[model samples]
Target chain A: MTEADEENGPDSGHDEIRSLVKGAFRGQQEDRVDVLAGVQAKIYDRSGGKFFSDGWSTSRTPPISTYLVTSWVMLLILAALYCVLAPISGEPKRVPTYPAPVRVIPATQ
Target chain B: MMRGLSVTVTEADDERRFLRRLQARDEHAFNELVQLYEGRVYRLVLRILGKPDEAEDMAQDVFVAVFRSVDKFRGDSKLSTWIYKIAINLCKNRGRYWSRRPSEAAEDLGDVEEKGWLEEGPARTTAELSAPDQHVQGYQVEEIVRRCIQELGPDYRDVVVLRDVEELRYEEIVEITGLPEGTVKSRLHRGRALLKARVSRLLGEKIE
Candidate 1:
């Protein structure tokens, strides 16, 4: 170990590095591990290849025509929904207002 | 999308068996593969990225890429080497695209060391230092430890961190870095000297 340590260079600060590493390990930043696991999960979900699960290309369509047709159908459905639900009407809806004076009653005895 | 060819299970040797299963798109083998090197990959990425969240995302990206491209992984090298190549490439892209230069990286030495000493409240930062503390933190110490590492002319930094902090064997490092063994050893020696000088400066500051 000393030879290897000496080979690395002057032994001036070797102790510092050793202590720093020990401290860092003692910190045991599990958050780092969790974050890494999250990455694994994301990759696994995207490429893990479970039967009928999340992945890059879930449905492998054969041709451009199939994609085009699907696109058209989806567009039509979206257009229809927009037409029905959109606030395209020029006039705003009228909410009937009641007189405010009726609620302003005199202070109770 | 890469093909959905099923991974083949064979009664062959270890590498062959693993490779066969991986090539055939066996999710079980893939999971096992992930289990094997997830820690190393994550640690490598975290060291590069410095942020837990970003490292995690990058690590996953590396594995996902591996999963998709396993078919193309000719067993010309060790599986770990191949995986490291993919991981390093992914980390490089992430670091590049995210504009994460080593210059912008934070230094943890003082904070880590201080915490080790105090065993108390949150670590004190260089910014909040008193004049005495600032003087104690000499230019050479600052230059040698923090900036020297950051200024280590990118090539050295990667090799140094990979070899020292991550503790990869020389051959494994050479495989991943594509540097000659002699070059690797040379850089390690130089990098260690620089690091030692920096650490010495910090100690001197404390004594003063």
Candidate 2:
């Protein structure tokens, strides 16, 4: 035995008490297993069929598919908005440009 | 050295797999975790609360919390250590709740016969006793020890239970309790000394 072990060797009194404590609570209760199942079921129900989904992943970030779908949908929406708001360009509109203002000042020789 | 490194790598890989399975809400993985930890959690809570029903409920609550927050576990510590922290926190909360309502803290010790361990007697030593007599004697001593443990303050009792009963390492105790290592050692020493003295007096025997 190590020196430390010898120094803190078991005492009869302590051993007796320790044994008593162990004996008092020896067996594992069976109901705790049932409790575990019940809690798992509760968690499953609360998660609402999303327990196995990517939302519950360790990183808990949105899935790539979600981001991809969202980006595509946004692009489609923006294209639709542009189509609705922008005027149909059949031909170039007539230029209504006026002549540049003639600023003819006296030439200083 | 290579073998040790391999063992470490294997353990890390296993832990990673377990965490992935848990986060994926694998029923088998959840069941395996529960089976591994439920007894220890229940026993720890029972030691703290001293009520079987409450301990059972708290044990369930601990696992439920773990299940709900499995995605948040970052694998910084052993899973058992995290579970122990949850159990300890729940026990502390329940103890505080009971303390707030003094009426609920009253326990009946009368169910066990009050045979003073310190009483002067020519009783047979445990070694000399028959098997049945030894069993009875052990039961009586256990009852006394349980009462003594219940009488200890929550701080002392928690340290004592984690150290003596659960047989956790000092570092693990520190992690679970969030106490400094020095404080954990001191509490454990004081708690053991106190139990030794009390049990010695009760048994009419020297502890050291």
Candidate 3:
């Protein structure tokens, strides 16, 4: 294969690049340090215990049960509101008056 | 095919359980997560950033990001893919900052070779003999290529690193980068070409 075609393609079956890429990272300091503490500390400190709080607020996503309960509560409130206000609020209080005052023929037909 | 499907389902279920624990702030689960992906995360950032110290910091930030945004992940993709996405975004953000201060960018690493691709065999250049380990010629070439990859623009750099260095598939790259499959392929093609040309030039230089 031509040298140009070696690393020219995305999936080119050339070992040069595969090996060279591997070699590039040789002798680099490995990331073996346990940063779990740092990560946890950052999460706790940055958000002021909003996350990783080890308590009620620990969950980044509240459970689905929370949503269901909230919806049910809201529906109950709406139902109670409708029952209490339905009779008092309807058709916006019709004004007691007779029919419109009839006007004589003013058509310019 | 049936087996693969079953395996995928099992994997998904396992991830869901793990994600639950993580989202719930299970310290043990989170610690397990660090143990699981920290090496890959560190290596990826090291390839992208070209510095071990920076990679360490970036990897920590990546995990922190994953922890902070676990709820945002909708299980539309694999957890590892999501983590890769976060790591890449952090890398790009830091890359942009470095680009703003060009002096501290890849040029600071070493002489980035110009684009040169030839049909002939490449000569082993000084760039290939200047790595930390002079005993291994591959390491020297590796160092030069690493620097060249860093020298590439962020758009091309991420694609090249993902495809070539990380050896990720195009589909995973699309999911991680949020680019169209065609865009990812085209960028990979272009990125690989750039990398080849750069390596060609560096490998052609005489040992000084």
Candidate 4:
């Protein structure tokens, strides 16, 4: 260990370094992050997605056409399933599409 | 021989598993790896480049590269070890690019000026700045440490920071630096001595 290190334990050394690093980070955050973000944004534009664009890219994936399509498909399937599995209100009976023939009209004629 | 082969296989398996998780885009695993080594990578880049912004960019770049090429990870050794190797190579490339950069020094000078940072001028006497209060002296010690580190040769500085400041194990240092063990040890020793002298100078200790 250096004489300075001997005077100060490794922990102190670490503390000092950590403070400097924190200061650096603070400086970066305050002054440079916008520029950095812009650069990263440009990179994203060029690459067609953000860095780490796979599943890990963003906290939440942005809404896209595919997302809407998937949601619609899922909703349709779910609605169909609900219709099929839900309890019926009454006994199942086919409603007549055409009225029982109006033979009364023919008898009057 | 069989044990050695098995060891290699085990290392490879671990790497393969990590890469597989990465391929599945595992953020937790990625963050785990970053948490494991970001300090070492940051210190390495900072010491090598002598610029914080560049170091941050490089650090991010290293991970981005890892993410891009995760599929190609052969997993012959430990994951950390392999990542360090790639980081060092990237640092070297960055170093080479920097050495060829004609405008970087001027740009850095501008950066310092814009930040209103003042360098220690030779005309200013240290005694004039020393305060009567003892608490200030403690703060001065930390500044001394920073300046002492800034003065060491890059090779020595890097190893010193990696070993003493970052506290990385010798084997990891070797894997990251691609230096032989003896070279690493020698660099650390020399670095410590140089650092000691500089700090002693800061403290006004006589060389006796």
Candidate 5:
């Protein structure tokens, strides 16, 4: 036990070291400024817009395409599963597509 | 146990989906990733490289590598773990580059050091720095810690920073370093001892 302690390993209670280590994290939040813009700029320049084609790479805001693509894919998959399984469960006549909204033309307008 | 495992599997699936987005270069996914990891990468690089400006550039380089090659990520370990591996690897590479061109690296970084940083901070002595007025002396202690951490050999510094400073798990450290578990343990032990000796010397204490 004494030998291990002498080594000052993780088992040792060196709170001072731990406390001081926070120094690494200390600095202006400005110093720790967001690198996303820099990273995007680099990737865009390096790849010649192979990545920045849509300007999303340079945009700080999260791209809408991310959520849209995932939602659309998942929705399509679920709809397909429901449509395929509907027939197996004796519901083939059910349609997956929503009926188009009725165009109620104003009568004799 | 079963519930825990299902939760774990679900998390893995979620990560896989996220990884796919990153691989596909989904703009929002990439943005989210940079925001999520920029702080951590900055901290690790700052501690390793020993300068805020250099750390920022290094951190940027790390994310660039991550985005470019994210498709190659095999998911053998967690995505964050893979990112740490990249950060540490880049730090090592930059460290080597600096050492190879001492005149240039020193000239550039020395200027940063001279302009209101550790070597110029108040509280000259460790004892004075350790006084109860943390708010007053905090900067000095922080600078001292940074210098001491930088002073150690890279082998020792990496383990010390990852284990003591970052407080990562042994297994995770092992993954980041790709060092054997036993080697990690031994190096961590020796690193801590060396750090303690440095601190003791700073305090002008006699330690066997």
Candidate 6:
């Protein structure tokens, strides 16, 4: 036991128990069995062997179909907004353009 | 520092790859997962259940549940944490079932007594005993510690096992158990105190 263990009054036996527990569990291993095979068989049966291709993956990215549908929906919404705003706003008030000055009076006829 | 960062990145990538393979129903990835965690799961279940047969069954069940629900694993926590949660929950359910069945509970209790460690006389002085006798005494002490741990309440036992035996960090334990940190700390504190008192008595020492 260390001084620190002693200082913690209730921990006097902590080290002893910890060591004994570790020893008891150290050499312990699960009995040899093909757990993977068992699990795979179960999953296969549950999913009718379609699990390999059809089960959900952990990936969170949206599917291609979902992305395509979302993009189309957003485009439709933007088009609708433009239609609603265009007539109300009209075209930008056309700026009146001034013609360039002509110096035709310099002919000494 | 750079090496450590790279190691962390590699581990993260490996875990992501493993998850992908598991999701894809790759048998090899499943085998590797079992190889990596089966022993720890077995030991944790054994400590919780105190019966080898049941612990073995429980450990297998944990993996099955993990495989079934691999898609639900959102990477919110470490895979080990999720597995621990499954094991702990299964143990808790088994405990509850056992409690409702008096005959089985009695049998387990009887087994504890039949082990005869607690009934053994006071601890012999190690200095006075022969070498073989000293060894026997030590073994008895170990048995006593194991029994004492078994006798702790489920809440305390779970925290004690996770913290002391498994040596998980407080945050990880909280994630596995879904308990607040304060609750985990208090339970651990009380569990240690109780274990200390029991072991001290078993060893014929005065309790401070």
What candidate 3 gets wrong by more than 4 Å, as runs, is: A1-9, A13-15, A26-31, A50-109, B1-4, B106-136, B205-208
Rank the models by DockQ, top first.
Answer: 5, 3, 2, 6, 4, 1
Binned by DockQ into CAPRI classes (incorrect, acceptable, medium, high), candidate 4 is: incorrect
- lDDT string, candidate 1, B30-146, tens digits: 667776777778876665555667777777788778877889988877888888878877866765665655454565566645544332222223333456655344322333343
Q: Which candidate is the best by TM-score?
A: 5
DockQ of 6: 0.10
TM-scores of all candidate predictions against the true structure: 0.53, 0.66, 0.67, 0.52, 0.70, 0.66
Native-contact fraction for each model?
0.10, 0.32, 0.45, 0.00, 0.45, 0.22
True contacts kept of 5: 0.45
Residue range B103-125, candidate 6, lDDT tens digits = 45423434544665543454433
- Residue-level lDDT tens digits of model 5 in B1-208: 9999999999999999999988888878988899988988898888888777888889999999998889899999999999999999888888788778744433332343355333323323233355555444555445555777787888989988888767789999999999998788878777767776774455344233
RMSD of each: 21.0, 13.3, 18.1, 10.8, 14.9, 18.0
User: Over the full model, what C-alpha lDDT does candidate 5 score relative to the true structure?
Assistant: 0.75
Indicate the residue-level lDDT of B51 in model 3.
80
List candidate 5 segments past 4 Å from native.
Answer: A1-10, A13-16, A22-31, A62-109, B1-4, B103-134, B206-208
Candidate 4 chain B: worst 10 consecutive residues by lDDT?
B119-128
The residue-by-residue lDDT of candidate 3 on B9-42, one tens digit each, is 8988999999999888776688789879888888
TM-score of chain A, all candidates: 0.25, 0.34, 0.37, 0.27, 0.37, 0.36
Candidate 1: residue B166 Cα off by (Å): 3.2
Model 4, residue A9: what's the lDDT?
A: 45
Question: What lDDT is reached at residue B158 by model 6?
Answer: 92
Task: Indicate whether candidate 4 or candidate 5 has the larger lDDT.
Answer: 5
Clashes of each: 3, 0, 0, 0, 0, 0
Angstrom error at residue B200, model 1: 3.5
